[model samples]
Target: MNSTTAVTAASPPTRSIRWALASLSLSMLLSSLGTSIANVGLPTLAQVFDASFQQVQWVVLAYLLAITTLIVSVGRLGDLAGRRRLLLSGIGLFTVASALCGLAPSLELLIGARTLQGLGAAIMMALTLAFVGETVPKDRTGSAMGLLGTLSAIGTAMGPSLGGLLIGEFGWRGIFLITVPLGLLTLLLAQRYLPADQQQAKNTQVAFDSVGTLLLALTLAAYALAMTLGRGQFGVLNLALILLAGVGAWVFVRVEQRVTEPLVRLAMFHDRQLTTRLIMSLLVATVMMGTLVVGPFYLSQALGLGAVEAGLVLSVGPLVAALTGVPAGRIADRFGARRMTLAGLLVIALGCLLLAVLPISFGVVDYIVPMVVITLGYAVFQTANNTLVMADVQAQQRGVVSGMLNLSRNLGLITGASALGAVFAAAGMRVTFVVALALIALACRCARRH
Candidate 1:
């Protein structure tokens, strides 16, 4: 075929691209759904495994650790390889791992399977935005992102209620079992309908940076461990891990600068807009994760609500985010990302401020109102912020950028999980909200500078 004909065929058709998005969304939903399912299932898992609460916590920790460690390297791998191949392979791995997780007879085996599930999720999370953005028309980028974000929110919202029902009916393993069928369906749809890969020339030789990959993985893993263990003043072990992470990070940067094919582009760090968005992503994750951890306890303790009642109250946020995200995406496309981001931050700050001064009252509205406001603001902010992060990046680097975003999220998660326990211990639950309010306000100020 002529060069012109080849180029034309390489571009995905609109209908097929939309199908790919649908499949990708399902894939994304499967990955994200696991993130929160374990949160609700932790207690049931403990009972089933005959383990302590802390021991069973490894089920969730293992997954988060694996995803955070490999995401950056895996993103670069996707760029060099055929993303279509990697994406489909990820779905397969996740499905197989889900089965393993369900069948595992011990806590150790379940944790190991959960780790594999994280590997699968890292592959999908790294590629989702880049794959969809590359496939869709530029005019529809915002809409596609909105749709993707909506599925993610839906997955998170489904986890608690779904896990509760599944565990109650079929035991703790039921949560993992349900994903098998849904994942199989998504795999079939993706394999049949996703666009063909446009690989590099067969004669060209490209090398993967094995050393840099090792350094990066060590750096991220060490850092996550240190932060997660830093529940209070860093102990001797935590301090040592933190120092090891610092050394690994320094070496990783040095290695990336020297490698012919670096795992991450050092120059991407120089892009002001990208850097700001990545930082904010980390901050947002920390605040949101901490709020999620603390909120349910606050509701039950403060309002004397049941497990079901607290779950219902927590549902309001994801519901709002799912409802608001697509419209926010559309608005970003029309009015520009910067202005929309500023507006969203202001709204979030307002919500946070309200929560900071929340009255001790019988009204459930006190908790429900701020949760909805913050989530709506978060949806608007995310719609605009995500667009800006990708605005200055190359098509090839989009996968890596997505990984960076995900990396920040995991950092925030580990940070929130580790640090907030200390705060709650020191200042009590309502004070935790006050602290979150302060952080949100700080993030709002940072958004203004951007």
Candidate 2:
């Protein structure tokens, strides 16, 4: 062999520009598919396991809670270790967990398996963005982020339909089975195509804040419990736990201030831009995520659609969201996140207005139009927020910050779901949508000022 050939063979090649983007897209798609696929399987799992509605709800809740809680922690951890290493480990764990979930005989076992799968998902998501940051060229970073957002949106959009089909044909196990090969493919692609960019952060002396992590987890858990249980359901013991959690959160804040390397950097909130943008993102996710739960129920119950049909229609928003991500990110990079976010909020408000005004006998076109508009708005808002969040932070801090964003949005989703559910029970879907629209309008005001 020639000397040049020999040299090339021995050394790692520089990343092909497209490969990094391709890898990022694939990883995100695989990770997102897990959430989407599970939603479809929920009904089937409930039937097969003979679970009550409340018990079956845990199947979705467990997954969301686990991923939401652990994502930031895992992201911070990935910085100390290696993104690639953590990414691979997460993929392997997720794949195995998916397989286990498929085989689970009992509802309890399935929930447990799903929780493990969520842990893996947290790792994968944390690394995917960090990986993009490290690997992609500066000009292309926004586009990459956009594409990642889009893929995730697509996965979410497709989730119900995919789950419905698989459940219909092969049973609930099919949902878990679907993720297995896709995850394996992602792992293989990552191994081959991912850049060899492993720049460990300099402060090896820095340690993870384990105490703070535990306290924060407790705080969120307490809040979630309070919301889920409601005041009526909470016993004396549950009330005490909630109080304890409040105390823990206060302690967590104190502990975080003292730590050299905190799991959540309290200082990031000091920036007006970062802080306001974060609030907007959180609010949007909360309202939008909550709306999703209502959509399926309304379509299936009030509109007389089958589960599969309802899911398919429900997927429209997410699909549009995914498709819009890259373009939104690109625009944010060029014109600034402020404008993109404002426009998105406005569009979302409009979509909600459309939903509120729809006739009692409105056809598919009526619903799909509003859903698509809302999703497109969601894509723009999310992409812009993501870009802005990462823009000011240094490379070394990206993982932790990224994790923080994930935590914020998930918290919003959890809160929205619980709060909106309560609202739905007390009032009605129409009132809930109208109130949510007003909230979105408030968010738009915030976005405009920001």
Candidate 3:
């Protein structure tokens, strides 16, 4: 291939760009689907491994923790190494992990495999946007991003139901195996149609932040481990893990201060607007992810529904988000993002309260109604909340801020699933819902700021 035809960040031929976008979108959808779909299998996993619901939740918690911790580091790695090379490696690793997960005979093995899967998912997420911008024409980049966002919505909406159906027929292993062929297809298209990253002057000169990476990873992983195990009792193991997290955080801050190129810029926190946006994102994620993890258990165990039935009921929230997201975007543009965010958080609080206070004798429809309401609130707030963050940041820091925002989101997912799982194990589902409601109300207060 001549230099003219070689895919570089600056420019590439138009003929194959469409295929590249499609492949990238598929990768994004695959990562998004990991959270939505795998959640449906929680109940089945609880039964298969003869584990408590809280224990099986490590399946989800470990995955989110791995992704959240590694995502920004991977993004930096992709730049130092080739973005295309890292993307391919991620896809390959994810494919292998999925197979391992399918064949795993024990819960511990499955959680370990899923952590590897989380790494793969993080690599894919780190580069998808950059690749899209490099490949898609700048003039039409907005349209391309919109398309990818839509795919994410559709995948989120359909994942639980599809996963439910897969598990019901083929068992939980089917959920992991289903990605194998699709992953292979995407890999082929990406290799053939995507451009290679051309070695650049900047990449050659910059040193990778290995120390910062280790410290941050330690901080996140230790904290995640502590929360996942801190359910009913204040055990020695939990306390030790928590102490490790504290030490890691302290070391991380010191390292970040000394590093030439830190993983996160502390100066960015000076932007009150940006910090608020990130907090709001975290709150929104807690609401969404908490419901997703808790909803299926309440449905399958409490309401006497099967996995397929729970999935169908759980899928409605995302479906409603998909239906309302675009309209909400338009409304945000017409009115304002703050108003939409406020309205959305209020609705979410209301939905949480409804779920927490509902009579024990409630039916399937009762569960679904609150979920749809919450989902509608999510769709309404997401665009507005994101717009506030992106609009506030300097163009130079957008990439960093965006990564932090996403990291916040993944943390929210873990918080909802793991921390709340512990609460569920000790107190019960309604109490967990009440805790989430409190978070939502606090987020609403954050939204009220400038």
Candidate 4:
């Protein structure tokens, strides 16, 4: 074809496409920012509410709980109701919740708003990448995922630093208010630029298994609460509640097996490749979250850095992960996902091992190198895992597949953080890292078999 003919044949780009992508990127940032941005405000929040350490921890915990509970359900809802429509609704709700959080006078009000904010966050988090997968061309999906991953990393890395600055200058309320204008801007863009749903909401009938959902939520709550109290001062009643939670979790799995439209498809376990990928996703996320929480504690305690400095140092992992995510995705696509995945697990193991042995005198360099290595591994692992999960599934089962994957990542992170926190409390920081390294090694072994 002639140059002129080729030019005429090529698809033209529209302003709306740019706007849609921009809006989606902002939504990702907002969702991630909400997760970590509150970290720096914990002490201030505690002071304002005259709360205990455990109570103040809820400022972060509530948000995680809400996200974990709602992500899969919201993702399924997005498939049923139209991803674009749900995306806009979620952004609006998130914005409103942010405003409420900023205005909250009491701890109860703040926690309530944060919970609502998590609901909104779940909507955006579920649909944002799914939208990209559907809207962007196949060739561009990796790039888009990479960019989204980068934005997510930046938001997380910036969280404590940004929150500290805002809290320092304007108080704890500023953390929530900072998201308002950005959320509103993203909402407006989404409304105008996001394409109409390819699938109409009215045509889809999705019957959510409310019983299964309730059981699952309780399982998570019980487990989280038990882990929280396991390391703290607790009464006999608390131990009984924890024991009850263990029983409830067993019930949850049994209930799920019998349900037609189960909360998590038990059949997914039959595919070793898919199962390994899913397990890797969960294990890596768990390690990442646990490491993120404990790293700062050690940095502050052993190194004597302030909150802001500690946050910056700890953010190196996410930053490195973000920076390398796209290239990692491209490499995964070029090479087979299995090799990339195995490599990622090995790299993560190395990072964890490094962290396990660091000396007391080590500073930022000591911290950044291992985190960057681990993050590089994470970027590769996540991209490969996502690709693997979607590879063999039928189009109709995409919702189920995605939902399970989302749930696994969140649940793993929650459980990992809680369990590791208890370990740190019991065995000291060094032992926690050692345990994390061992887990990563186990995950790597699992990945190798795939």
Q: What is the model-wide C-alpha lDDT for candidate 4?
A: 0.78
Which runs in model 4 stand beyond 4 Å of their true positions?
Answer: 1-17, 229-246, 257-260, 304-309, 357-364, 391-395
Please give the lDDT score at residue 373 for candidate 4: 85
- Stretches > 4 Å off in candidate 3: 1-21, 36-62, 79-85, 99-113, 129-150, 153-173, 189-204, 230-234, 297-309, 326-339, 356-365, 387-400, 418-434
Question: Which rank order by TM-score, best down to worst?
Answer: 1, 2, 4, 3
lDDT of 3 by residue, 302-323 (tens): 8999966766676677677767
Pick by TM-score: 2 or 4, better one: 2
Per-candidate TM-scores read: 0.93, 0.88, 0.78, 0.87
lDDT of each: 0.81, 0.77, 0.76, 0.78
Best by TM-score: 1
lDDT of 3: 0.76
Off by over 4 Å in 2: 1-15, 197-199, 229-244, 300-309, 358-365
Instruction: Please state the error at residue 437 of candidate 4 in Å.
Output: 2.2
Q: Candidate 2 local accuracy as lDDT? A: 0.77
* RMSD (Cα, Å) of model 1: 2.9
Candidate 2 lDDT over 1-450, as tens digits, reads 322232245453455546656766777887788876776566677788887778887777777777877788888887776667778889899999999999998899989999999899888887787776666555455777798998888777777777878888998898898889988887887877765534445345678788877877778777666655543344676677679778988898899999887888888778777788778877888888777867877787778889668766876777678668888889877887768878888888988888888875877776888888888888888887787677556656677777877777877876677777667767767887887798899888887777
Taking every candidate in turn, the Cα RMSD to the unseen true structure, in Å, is 2.9, 4.9, 5.1, 4.5
Q: Please state the error at residue 161 of candidate 1 in Å.
A: 1.2
Could you say which candidate leads in lDDT?
1
Once model 4 is optimally superposed onto the true structure by TM-score, how far is the C-alpha of residue 20 displaced, in angstroms? 2.8
Report residue 262 deviation for candidate 2 (angstroms). Answer: 2.1
By TM-score, the better pick of 1 and 2 is 1
